[model samples]
Target: MGNGLIYVMAVNIVIWIGIAFYLFSLDRKIKKLEREMNDPSH
Candidate 1:
């Protein structure tokens, strides 16, 4: 039972980590697009 719980928890942790990375990258891309829009060169 304890081992099964640990595996479940680990899978949850991995999913959350992937989500966090995706969100971070999305934020970075948004910021870059905003900068490009505001820049005179574009």
Candidate 2:
């Protein structure tokens, strides 16, 4: 039972980490687009 609980916790942590990274990447892309829209010179 203890081993199963550990595995569940680890999986949850990994999923959250993945979500965090995905959101971070998406934010960067959105910011870049906003910058380009604000300044067409680029």
TM-score of each: 0.90, 0.90
RMSD of each: 1.4, 1.3
Error of 1 at 2 (Å): 1.2
- Model 2, position 41, has a per-residue lDDT of 100
Candidate 1, poorest ten consecutive residues by summed lDDT: 1-10
What digit string (tens of lDDT, one per residue) describes model 2 on residues 1-26?
68799999999999999999999999
For model 1, the superposed segments whose C-alpha errors exceed 4 Å read none
